[model samples]
Target: MKTYYIKNALRVLLGLFMTVAGIGHLTFQREEFLAQVPRWLPTDPAFMDFVVLSSGIVEITLGLLMIILVKHQAKVGLALAVFYILIFPGNISQYVNEIDAFGLDTDRKRLIRLFFQPVLILWALWSTGGWKYFLSKVKK
Candidate 1:
């Protein structure tokens, strides 16, 4: 019971973090986020802005749904995990291209941050019982 509550609290915290991150993508930190957009993508300013804006919207929606869709959390968590996977290339690009953003100004720091992506994936799954949900589906 206590563990469940802890997970719930962590889930909510993650939701809040996502919400704020989305807002940053669209607003004050827009330029910073632009740095993380893969350089291999079109460098056209408008297109890059569009990518950031659209992702921000998705993040906001997912964050809200994560908080409100408690009964469907496993599904939501799975979706969030997939979203993280989809965006992982941006992190990889940052590392490979040696771009600096969000205070990760060094190769070592950026490389270390890359490893945290898996942790986020695991967090999304574990906090919402998504691991069990995935396993149950897979075994069928």
Candidate 2:
């Protein structure tokens, strides 16, 4: 019972984090987000802005769903994990290109930041029971 409460608390925290990040993408941190966009992507500023805007919308939606969809938490968790995976390339690009943003100015800092992505993935899965749900299916 205690564990359940802990997980719920963590999930709520993650939801809040996502919500803030989404707002940042849409507002004050827009340029910072653009810095993370893979350089290989088209350099047109308008297109890049579009990508940021659309992704921010998705992030806000997912964050709200994660908080409000208790009965569907596992599904939302899975989708959030997938979303993390999809956005991972931007992290990779940031590290590889040494694009500084959000205080990840040094190579060591950028490398360290890379490790947090997996933690976020695991957090999304574990906090919402997605890991247990997957294991149960695998055993069948």
Worst 10 residues of 2 by lDDT: 129-138
Tell me the alpha-carbon RMSD of every candidate.
0.8, 1.3
Count of steric clashes across candidates, in order: 0, 0
lDDT of 2 by residue, 71-119 (tens): 9999888889999999998999999999999999999999999899999
TM-score of each: 0.97, 0.95
- TM-score for candidate 2, please give it: 0.95
lDDT of every predicted structure (CA atoms):
0.92, 0.91
What's the true lDDT of residue 36 in model 2?
84
Q: Candidate 2: give the clashing pairs.
A: none
**Pairs in clash, predicted candidate 1:** none
Off by over 4 Å in 1: none
